[model samples]
Target: MFPWGDSDSELIEVQGPRAAIAKPKSFHAHGVHFWEIGSDKRLAGAILHHCRSGIGKLRACTGGDQLALFKIGITHDYDSRFDLYRSHGWEKMLVLFYSSDLGQVEMLAPAKHVAAIAAAFAKTSSDGALSAIARCPQNDAERAMQKALCKFDLTLDAPVTYVNVGEQCLVPCLKPTDYVRTLNERGYLHRLIGCPIDSSAGALSEFWARLSKAEPQLEVCQDLADGLVDPRTLIPVYIHGDGGRTYKHDELMIFQFQPCMGHGTMHSRPVKPNSIGVSLKGHSFTTRFLFGVLQKAIYSNDPSTFERFLEHMALDLQSLYHVGVKHERTGVVFKFCVIGVKGDLPFLAKAGNMNRTFLHIRKRPFLPHSPEDPPSFFKLDVLHLYHLGVGRDFGASSLVYLMTLYEAESIPKAIEKLNSDFKSFLLSSKKVVHFKQITKDLLGYISSKAYPVGHWNKAMDTPVVVQFAEWLVEKFGGESTPDLLIRSGCKAIGVCMRTMLSSALWLDRSEAKIVGDAALHFAQCYGKLVHYFSRKVSACTIWCQNYIFGTISH
Candidate 1:
């Protein structure tokens, strides 16, 4: 008997809510619209094919010529070897046909691809593959399977069909629609998981819950609040420690899981691992507390808040130092340390380490003092070093030529002159001027054809070299002093001028030698200054040896 009834009209209004809604109409508004798009023809063919053969392909005509070739269908031929297996045999495959252009058409394979069809019937009693395929496409595939079973009396001996073990009768444990509705209402289903419910929910839920609970809580120190410290202060002290602090008594025992199969033994043994012992000393609680606060501030995502927190922490440490001094004990010292990778050391040394307040602490006692030596207490963080040192240096260097031209004595004055000059230049001319307009103009002039390249290339042009040397001396004041070299603006200008002169082939051997000697003298003086500052700051603080890690063990 024909499962879709004897006549075409009866098939169109087949018994079932889906068929009732999906069925075509002849005299309705939506019917008229569907008719205009030839949905009647496609629907009729789909119904007829599905009723007779239990499988059908339906192609909608509403998406223009581009979508005319697109189709949705079911095929038993997808797994031809299914009959050879004892498990669910002759599995049906849902296929979606798509075409980029009229000439090329291809099927949208299952999410698991060919493997899903190949593994349709597992060797074990459980038909996992068939269950997986059924669960994959909740709407289309499930509806098509129901139609197939009703029309052709098809039997799928899948895991979902088994009510209990040894039962041959087909029965679903839970309807897919009911299960999906239940999961959605329970808040377990969402777009992020990409399905109504995850297959491994039973195993993963407990672990996920534990992980959430185990997550660490981060809190900021109330003592290190804003309005406590001066942002412009030369030294920012964010840590404090006493020289006599210790952490050796607090030993941690660790264990590892070992496999049973091992040489000379039937059972695995718990072996003691090699370890590096660290001793903690000096204001451990204070250092840890401040570090925690700093960490929280850094991760807060508010720069203004972070800056305020940093300033307050610095002032708090400074206050602590004063308190220690009043008690005749070791005071908290403001030793600024900036650590970074080798490439970053140069810029960091020039930026943070160049300050007159702090000194670079040497790693090895035998090693000669060098400008590249990093700060004493703090290890260099790449983010902080890049943003504060290298990044800021680039911006500062861009204004060096303009600052030199204006001959500003300080950074603030140079910035003021730059802004004013830029504004005036913009008001008078159509050309836009930036903060580093003078530097760009100087670079352009030097690179231009009118610039004397020959004079720079020759060794006899002592006048050009002398002219640059005199300019440097005048701007820096005392060319031989490290204090002069340590000034960021002077260093920037010297580096910029040296680069331009070298690039122009203007720096002869004698001129290069003079610049080189002056740079060396600056380095020597800078190293001495760093050491001197270190000694001076050590008097206020405990001056305990610090580890790069949070622990400061004596």
Candidate 2:
């Protein structure tokens, strides 16, 4: 009996969980069998077995939409790869082959045979035979395949038929005569007018002056006379597109403003109510601009620039009351709210800056810091702390320094010895194992040497801590004697770490807390060094704690 059983070919029964007991299977309906062969060799073997058993000759083979009763063969050796298939006559068979670990199906039929196959399949199905091709190549490969098929001119004698197949059918219709009138009545559409200009600093200043003269009610500031500065010259400022809108009927318009010195360009979009536009241009009297300049000065480590920036910032905020009162008189409301500020330690700690800003305000007799006030004052970037303070400065630099002390050849030899020991232990155990299991067992064995080091309170006396401190002293000499070169390396590490770890939203809060605690302990133990390594590490720990308990908690 055949594998499918000697039933009528049109009504053969399929054997599976979903098979019906009362009804016979239809001629067109068949169950698909899927096999996941482990390797190319196994796939080749399976193909050869199918051919030898005459399964390929008996079963119908499908390539794209074309079906044929064709012989299939798997090439066993490279010498007979193409020659064997070619000798068998291309029209008589389809070849099963493997290349670069992927299974490929190739047609051996000539153009005439391909054309006949395409035409016959097209007549039997609504979708053309070409559409039936499984895992069709795309782009250039698709175009090449089409070009090859076109050579055969696979035209059908019958008209092409299409089945609905649940696809939506769109019907064309004419709009009602009153559609425009109905839209007008609803007031759903508005006309927009746009004007494009060169928008250089001089042009922007002139435009602002003309606008201010035309609409004195808008109360455009006197600062507009100087024109807008290039945005690229300063740290980027981005406002959400949806923000700063107070009215639904507000028009959306963007004015391109180029800087005077040809530095870079910026855009100005007018806010609602007064049509007063603001660009990311800084002035000597604006707090926002002063703050930006302060940041640049801090980053560049310029003391003169830092002082100058602070002086300008102070002058800007001096007329704060008058500016507010003036805008109120003109029916224009000016609002300023400082959200949390993020910066590295040096920047935030500068005199009359983050630290002193809060202190001065708190000391005032009239206005005092209150618990009800929002905590949007100053924030340290947690990433800067972890990467710059802990990972780069301490962990990575220490590891690199330790590596430098050992001979290059000795390190590889040590690793080889460890690997050999691990493999020997695995072999002696005689248990079924996988990559993960071996790794777990190896790490478990190695960690035994570093275990029993109690909590942070006992960290000072911990064997690991003692050993590391001793090693540090022995490797680099007395604590008082500073290695400027190695210290510079630590600083470089801190800089890199800050850059890499600046974003912490992706990390689990608990994980961040744990790392922060570890860093704190590290700083407390080793921070007394004159090189200030501990101070940097402590900064990261503090930042982490602040982030977890403050930002995330709120």
Candidate 3:
């Protein structure tokens, strides 16, 4: 981050990441020393004036509770001008600052108050004497700084710039120190960061010692203890991308990081505060964060393009890691050790430097496909598979059977009667439905056509579906029912769907086990049921209908 030389060495050392235009520099709000480097003394093409390092104190202001602001007045041979400023005290960093004129400041309030106090002794009215005072007359020869209040200013700010990273990629990178300072000014950075401390071997050694005593089971707890004493604050950044719509329904790959304070807090907060985005347009998703924009896009066509950019970005971040940035709220120079990359499986696989292919590329049907791992390795969301999926099948078939058993002159009347009862049941249950109401089209059972399916919200409508069918069965069919096989088949299938929602977001373990057992049972039962019943039998026809109609919601 900082290049130090011998005491006799006057050569100003400058370094930058490979493919970077200028050497990395930090703007530490806290006191930080800067080496005055002339153009002839350092790397060619770098128009640098200063070199700030993780060294001694060079304060902007001596007082506490006062904001340190710097003047950006123009001067020819600025090198000589800044040298004079060194005698007074000012840190000029190589990093760019986003500055605008804040206007020429005047010390009128304090001066007026002092003058008013003096006027009191003279027996002249303090208020009248100050109130009557007008603007001072100005001449062209007067100092541009002015002896009176004027409209103009010279102040430094957080500078965002477009810099080259690779041959084809250029990204708008904010100085890491500036971003961190911005966070601290907002006064909520403590909640996001796990620990904040100054850099010292003693502090780091103390942290590792405390960490050694912590139980290995508490991952996040141990992580919190990283920056508590040590200055090297480890932050987890996640990169996730896919061709899908965002929560707002915009298409992009979103990157984010988790809050690391308190126990299990890291995992609890999954919202991404910072990111490089990927957009989905023209049937192709793009990793965009390159050149002249707040975000850079890494072309997804070549994964190595992204890999190279990261290498460059990492080199840039090393400055902040070692030199540190000042926190506005805490008034402490915090050296961050941002590491631990975590994200979705696909992103991790693509981003990681490994020989293994966790995901296979697929295009049109003509495109060749192969698996790095077996089909069994891949998992599906059990909630979608069961809760909103196969479970609906059982509901649809049971509804169809119940209506058929209603014994009206025709199937239409039977469906209408069952629909009335179902509405009453929903009212009694006081359940909210996503869809307005269950319609004949949703059921696939109108006068013109004859099919039945369950269509409703995944979770809320499930209980109603099950209870309605069971109620109708007990009310009319009972023990004398002929479509007993149909209802039995639906429940059997549901037993297989014993999949939890959040608990089993994926059928990685428990749900998979349930699914396996249920499938095996279904296969064995189907073999006997199909063999026992003739092809022409209505029992087999009804069972097939349940499987087809009920499993898929309309």
Candidate 4:
């Protein structure tokens, strides 16, 4: 008797409630909705032939396709494999090994392919010939001998009869249905052992050792079964750090993922994209907080700390949005209360009064100041940046072009008024400047094109519009800096403009059209300002060091 074979003669009680519902309709290849280069019917037939007879000559046989089928069946349960093979167009199927015995090849093939495999085995005159011969049984003793032969391939002189074995036994193979059901409920499949023995002969307890070793080797052909979408990539925006100047940055600075449906299509939407969006929102909040902290640090005489903060903020932004190319050429900058872009646009909008008040902190504003203010350039303020175009066409949102701000005493009260003003502008009044321009442009354009205005209702509900009110408050209410800070602010205006323009040009393609030309022009002019601040900062660092340490010898 096999050392670990369970007794086949023992009376075993089978107990379980019947399935509550009929078996679900099995998914087949014909059921799949797919359009591809080849015919699955022909492919399925070819696969069936190959499994039974071996791959002799198939015109388009790729090893990758062959491997895919094998891995699909062995790793995935039957139902999943069927769906996968049907969808992926696998033209060949074969087995590698069984969980019960790793050394031997297990069942392989199309349902009809087994007949050819059996015929092939009948012709082979190796030791495997006995395994084939045992398939045919003439009488009870021959059947018993065949059953005994299945236990060990070795031949013995004594005829192994069912009567001598003391009992007839049936070892049913665990069906794929059971395996899949277990996996669905438990999140994994249990190792099943199939071994036959005379039940009258012994207890099943003796087989525990062999049963323990029945675990199938699990190799994930595709690690991401739900099609490669991880929730982390969609919504990552937070940057956390100690209160010091240490900035944690991400090396993989871009958010890129292959949606199952493919890119640029709705079906290719990443699984859990909404969750990712939320996660990225949290990250944005964190980055905004840190950017504020770093700017404050700069005022505290720790400007170098802003560099670290910029690194964190840059990574946080990249995690959610496709802004890697922007950050690459344009070095991201962080300040005490607001982070600014060193490129054509400030990827981060300033929170609170940083743009309004911190005009003299650096040699230039982080964005191009309008031409109105002055000896240097226009003083960077929310009014000038948004209303007159801050970063240029590419860096600035079309919506920002619609806003203008005036000084307010208490920010929260101001925000309430701002909200009321926006509501009035949209619903009650037609006096807002930007809306007037938009309405005129839109009406004229629509009259010419003959498109109805109702189509734009969805755009009215766009997140940009819906969130604009709260966004404004968040931007200004977080920290309050007095306009006097603007007086002490150095000319960071130059550096801000330069960074934006350079980044804009670097990311633009050579064949860019008229819009591209405008963007490039913006980048070129703004980028030049960065150079001015670099020289001034270099000189100031030296002067501050010399004045404080009393040693310029180094």
Q: Single out the weakest 10-residue window by summed lDDT for candidate 4.
A: 254-263
Clashes of 1: 10
Q: Where in model 4 is the C-alpha error above 4 Å?
A: 1-283, 286-292, 295-424, 428-514, 517-554
Global local distance difference test of model 2: 0.30
True lDDT of residue 270, candidate 2: 28
- CA error at residue 497 for candidate 1, angstroms: 17
Worst 10 residues of 1 by lDDT: 253-262
Q: Residue 464 error for model 1, in Å?
A: 26
Clashing pairs in 2: 64-132, 64-133, 383-501, 387-497, 388-494, 388-498
lDDT of each: 0.29, 0.30, 0.40, 0.27
lDDT of 1 at 398: 29
List runs of model 2 lying over 4 Å from the truth.
1-305, 314-334, 339-342, 352-379, 401-407, 410-554
TM-score of 3: 0.33
The digit string of per-residue lDDT tens for model 4 on 360-383 reads 333232222232432222113322
Clashes per model (N, Cα, C within 3 A):
10, 6, 16, 41
List the candidate numbers ranked by lDDT, top first: 3, 2, 1, 4
Report the number of the highest-TM-score candidate: 3
lDDT of 1 by residue, 317-368 (tens): 3332232111112222211111111222322332243323223222211111
lDDT of 2 at 432: 27
The parts of candidate 3 lying over 4 Å away from their true place are 1-371, 374-378, 446-463, 480-554
Alpha-carbon deviation at 284 in model 2, angstroms: 23
Clash pairs, model 1 backbone: 241-282, 242-282, 242-283, 245-281, 245-282, 279-553, 280-553, 339-380, 456-505, 456-506
